[model samples]
Target: MDKQIYDEMIENLYWAFPLLKTKLVKPFDKEEKEKENDLTGTHMTILFMVKEKGSICISEIGKHLGICKANLTPLVQKLIDKSYIERFVDDKDRRYTFIKLTSVGEDFLDNKRYKVQEFLKQKVSDLSEADLMTLSASVAGLREILMKIK
Candidate 1:
C-alpha cells in the first residue's frame, strides 16, 4: 500500500475504534445484560470459544483468550457460579479439566445475538442497498484481519 493510504487507514482506526467499542459495540453487551445474559466481554468470549469447540481444556482456553491461569481461574469460577458453564474431568486423564457451556448459556447467546441482529437491521434501515453492501464487505474484511492478528 502507498504511504498516504496507509497513513489515512491508521488515522481512521485511531478515531473509529473507540467510537465503535464504546458506542456501537457496547449496546449489544448492554442488551445481553438486559436479557439476563450478563457476563464480562472476556467471559462471554471464553464461553463462545468453549461453545465452538464443544469441550476444551482449561489451559487451552486460557491460551486462546490470552489470559493467564491465575486470572482465568476466577473467570471460569464466575461462569460456573452463574451456571453458564461447567467443568469436567477428562475420562482418560483425571488431571485434565475441560470446560463446556451449559444449555442455558447456548440459549442465552443465541437469543442475545438475535436481538443484536434486529437492532442492527433497524439501525441500517436508512442506508441504501449499495451502502449496506459496502458496510457488510468492510465488516467481513475487518473480521478476517482480526482473526489473522489474534
Candidate 2:
C-alpha cells in the first residue's frame, strides 16, 4: 500500500475512534449517572483499564494511555477520593506505587458494563450469525493492529 494511503487510513481511524465511542458507548454510561457527579468518558476508561489490569503503576498507565504522570496523577487522585481506586506502595520497591480498583470500582464497572451489554444485545439480536462472526473477527484484527502500534 502507498504511504499516503496508510497515512490517511491512520488519520481516519484516529478520528473515528472518538465518534464511535461517543455514539455507541457514552450514552449508556451517562444514563445512570447523577447530574452533579457524572463521570467523563476518559475517567470511565481509566477505571476500566485499572480494573482489568488488576494492579498497575502510574507510569505504566500513562504509557498505555499516551498521557504523562503529571496529567494522570490528578485523575487517579480523583478516583482515589471517590473510593473507586486505591494506591499503595509496592512491597518490593518503596519508590514504586501500584493502583488497583477497589470493590466499589469493580461494582461500578460491572453495572456500567451490564448496561452496555444489554444495549448491544438488543441492537445485535437481529444480526445474522455470520455477520456477528465477521464483526467479532474484524474487531479482533483491529485490536491486534492496535497492540502492534503500541
Candidate 3:
C-alpha cells in the first residue's frame, strides 16, 4: 500500500472507533448500567468465542483471544465455577481439554444479543430512508472488508 493510503486508512480507523463506541456501544451499556455484571469483559469474550466455535480446545481459545494459557486459566475457571461453561477432557486424547457453553450460558448470550439488536434497531429506526440505505451499504462493505483480515 502507498504511504498516503496507509495513512488514510489509519486515520479512518481512529475516527471510526470512537464513532462506533459512541453510536453503538455506549447506548446499550447505559441501558444495562442498572444490572450488575458478575463476569468481567474477558469472561464474556471467552463465552462469546466458545459459543462461536462450539466445542473448542483450551489452547485454541487462548490463541484466538491473544491470551496465553497461563493468564487464561483463571478466566476459564471462573466461567466454569459459574456453571456457564464446561471443560471436558477429550476422550480419544486425554491431553486435550475442550470448552463449551452450558444451557444457561447459551440463554445468557441469546438474551444479550437480542437486547442489543432490538436496542440498535430502535435507535436507527428514525433514520431517513436514503440515509438508512447508505448506512446499510456502508456496514455491509465494512464487514466484507474486515472479514478479509484474519
Model 3, 1-150: lDDT tens digits are 699999998999999989999988877787776687666678888999899889899998888889999999999999998888999999999999999999988998999889888998999999999999999999899899999997
Which parts of model 3 are misplaced by more than 4 Å?
A: 1-4
Q: Candidate 1: list runs displaced more than 4 Å.
A: 31-37
List per-prediction Cα lDDT, in the order shown. Answer: 0.85, 0.83, 0.89
**lDDT of model 1, residue 13:** 92
**lDDT of model number 1:** 0.85
Q: Candidate 2's residue-wise lDDT over 40-118, tens digit each?
A: 7668878988878899888888888898888989888989998999999999988988999999988978987887789
Quote the lDDT for 4 in model 3. Answer: 100
Model 2's TM-score against the true structure: 0.74
TM-score winner, 2 or 3: 3
Assess every candidate by TM-score: 0.83, 0.74, 0.87
Q: In the order shown, what is each candidate's alpha-carbon RMSD?
A: 2.2, 3.2, 1.9
Q: Highest lDDT among the candidates is held by which one?
A: 3
Output the number of the TM-score-best candidate. Answer: 3
Ranking by lDDT: 3, 1, 2
Off by over 4 Å in 2: 1-19, 29-37
Give one clash count per candidate, in the order shown. 0, 0, 0
Query: How well does model 2 score by local distance difference test?
Result: 0.83
